[model samples]
Target: MQKTNELSNLTKWLDQFPLFHSGDEVDEVRQKVGHIFVPHNLNVIGQEQHLSADMNHLNLENTSVNTLKYGAGVKITCDPFEKFLLIMLPMTGVMDAEVENGRVKACNDVAALINTSDPLSMNWGEHCNQLIIRVNKSLIERTCETLLGHPIKEDVKFASALDMSKGHNIYQSVIHMLATNPFLAESAKLYPLITKQLEHLLASSLLLNQQNQYTQKLLNPEKIITPLYIKKAEEYMNEKASEAITLQDVANNVGISLKTLHNGFQKYRNDTPKNYLKNLRLELVRKDLIAAKLEKSNTTVTEIALRWGFIHLSHFSESYFNKFGEYPSATLKN
Candidate 1:
């Protein structure tokens, strides 16, 4: 049906759909489709309406479809659900989808899909338009298997929305076929093609997910430890332990944001940036103490600690004792 003439009809149809009206009902739907409902605009009359549909064959107990109409600056809220995958295609304008801690911007030529099995809220605005497909967990899993060589892990939170990139032309072809060919409503031959396209799209998304994981690993290696910055910071700490060193110094030397550095270290080392540096200095002191013992040489605990950035003799002694369960002098004797 023409988008304009079908707007009201589609709205009426959505109102009657099993999962559109109530929050509880939406939740049940999400368990099957993996998402909750949000409001959208359907203004495609004289001008082309940006047509987007959310479809879930598994969630609908077969197939369920929802249509949206949104304008500039308009807002809508969809109830959260567990295990939802939403595929959105915008026909016109641009759309920005925000979910939980992540966001994606999409234009007419692109489509975005976001997958989440946890409760989430989304906001779209500013000339945003879209088509959404909500697929069930099992169906998506199966589809992923067909597209990817291996199965998708259950815990992975797929994007709630994805913008088509390399697969844009393929996606557009599917959209055109769905929009113009009424025969698609009945022809069985189209099923294989549709499934194939879905597989391609899902595979592309899987790659994107892997890339995002790698990026996050690079950005946040562990507990404020980044691979790129850790070596630099460690070298600086070793050289300047006797001198005062601050997080800002390390961040500036490495040319990264303090927060980024902190997060990177946290991910890589499982410790705070400052703590890791301090531990490194303490390790140097311990090595020196042990080396003196091996050489049958004498080195004062105070001298070793101070050389390694421990300014307060007593405090250094306490920290050293706590770490190694012995006084620094004991280590020198060992």
Candidate 2:
């Protein structure tokens, strides 16, 4: 008899990897599943039924893609995940999940995101099968920081539901390709570089697509290119900080209009170019003062301040005190 083809890309992908585990014993299946995911309680919900569990796990450098199913109706409970986030995409049937925020009925074209810190319980129908993507918690946070161009002051949290039923979803497409394509499997093994890049692509997709703490900042068109523009402006300012360069000069050198430069800095950095340059010069002056103190040099504060473009001693001293809580002389003195 000819074998029937599987309809889900996830099933095709799972065929490439060796079967991680498969059995009917509930305890054995639970232990094997827990080893791949997290420790959890799994029980058959129907009377006179036993588990018909099948699992295939594919581990990449920073993420894992998996497919799992229990051929009998089952209930599962898991404590809050501490180290990874799970995206559960159902390929067939339905899985109802109770997450921290609310309940989600995940099925074809609708998915559930298990946030790293949310407690979870799920009920899988006897025929339900799912493609689960497990991403390292730190990787997602780091990607958020990278996209924002700053450290995240708070733990990043994503909304628990993802609607893939509409529009082009790069994340969903990539995951689906990963599940069904044999080229990626071979490429992942043959090229470490491609593996890392693929991991980043996966993280970026979910972050940019799903609602999250950083989504507004990440998706804002005005803020999107601001980080790059601001960074270049800062670089130009730092190079010409001690020179008699104007904000217009900095803007011209950085290839942005003066007004744009000003608006970008004000909106993102909360300071104008003039103030930022002044602060930068003030820092340079303080560094010299500290160096002079350490070396016991006879260099006076006036001479060092002048070299850094600060013409007025009194004004410079006041700004220095405001920034460092001490006068320039105090910084230079024992």
Candidate 3:
């Protein structure tokens, strides 16, 4: 039923006060939340005493959503949105979220990264306090292109599940954003530099970490790589080998485009940027393994290798043997 009494402050309404109305009120809520997100159709699933939402913008580029709702449940649906990528991270309760064919069981540690072009729906549990982020779509796409050194042929897609487990840079970035709750809670606005830096950081982290259509090429550039872009890309890589980075990131940091970067690596190094970076990390890891062994310490291959993004232990071992003429373990012992 349409209730005209709902507060117009949907983005800032705290649920603590005795206020929430009906379907129409919730619709108005959706409209107010638009400053930070796209409008969505919300259906209240059960009778509830309090259903409230509050949002704070880091800037036009990012918005943080704080919501508390109680009832049997609620569903929020959206078709393709012209802007913003929706990322929902539950802090108190679980939310069942789906985007196209991918489903995410969102909890305190897991989040749902949604691409707005795909139809999305979320079912929130009776008691849920969730934090949501609406990231600017154009900013992300542009960053992706800069990293790729080329235009994207398909929509930028993100893996449905955002695992907050250790080593996932995206998860760490999200946590860093949340840690800035003081600024969000202090005022409805933020300094341009503060917010813009945060938005750019999130965009960069996701493009580098999230598994998407461009992941393989970004991670392991091949067949097309050449020498023109090689020296610059290699210098960039050598400068930041310890950090989590992709070929696209290197391409972006270097003043070259992805195609030109590929040409440079091929022409000079006769190797793909990805391959060179991988070997560099492997060599670094071997050096550490040997030093650890010499010290008679507790260092192990698995622990040392994972730190360098080497997940496939067998493959790493094989490559280590090929490059050094001995297994990693042997290298460590010697």
Across 1-334, the per-residue lDDT of candidate 2 in tens digits comes to 0011233643665765655545788888888899887899998986538677778888875678788877788999999887788888777778999998899998776779998888999999886778888887767876776777654556668888877564687886677666666676678767857877878888898889888878888998344445687999899889888799998898888888999998998777656789889878988997899799879999999999999988888998888875554578976884
Better of 2 and 3 by lDDT: 2
Check candidate 2 and list the clashing pairs: none
- Report the number of the highest-lDDT candidate: 2
Model 1, position 80, has a per-residue lDDT of: 44
lDDT of 2 at 162: 77
Per-candidate TM vs. native?
A: 0.37, 0.64, 0.54
Q: How would the candidate models be sorted by TM-score, starting from the highest? A: 2, 3, 1
In candidate 2, stretches whose alpha carbon ends up further than 4 angstroms from where it belongs are 1-10, 19-21, 221-334
lDDT of each: 0.50, 0.79, 0.65
Query: What alpha-carbon RMSD in Å does predicted model 1 have with respect to the real structure?
Result: 20.1
- Residue 49, candidate 3: C-alpha displacement in angstroms: 5.4
Clash counts for all predictions:
45, 0, 15
lDDT of 1 by residue, 1-334 (tens): 1242332332343333333322223333334333344333222222323323233221222122344434433333344433345566654455556666566665554445555443333444534434455544444444443343233334345544443444533434443333333343344343644644543454344433534333353334334323767777767766776678798988898888999887876665545778767766877897888778667776787888877778888888887664444578776763
Ranking by lDDT: 2, 3, 1
The positional error of residue 152 in candidate 3, measured at the CA in angstroms, is 1.3
TM-score for predicted model 3 compared with the true structure? 0.54
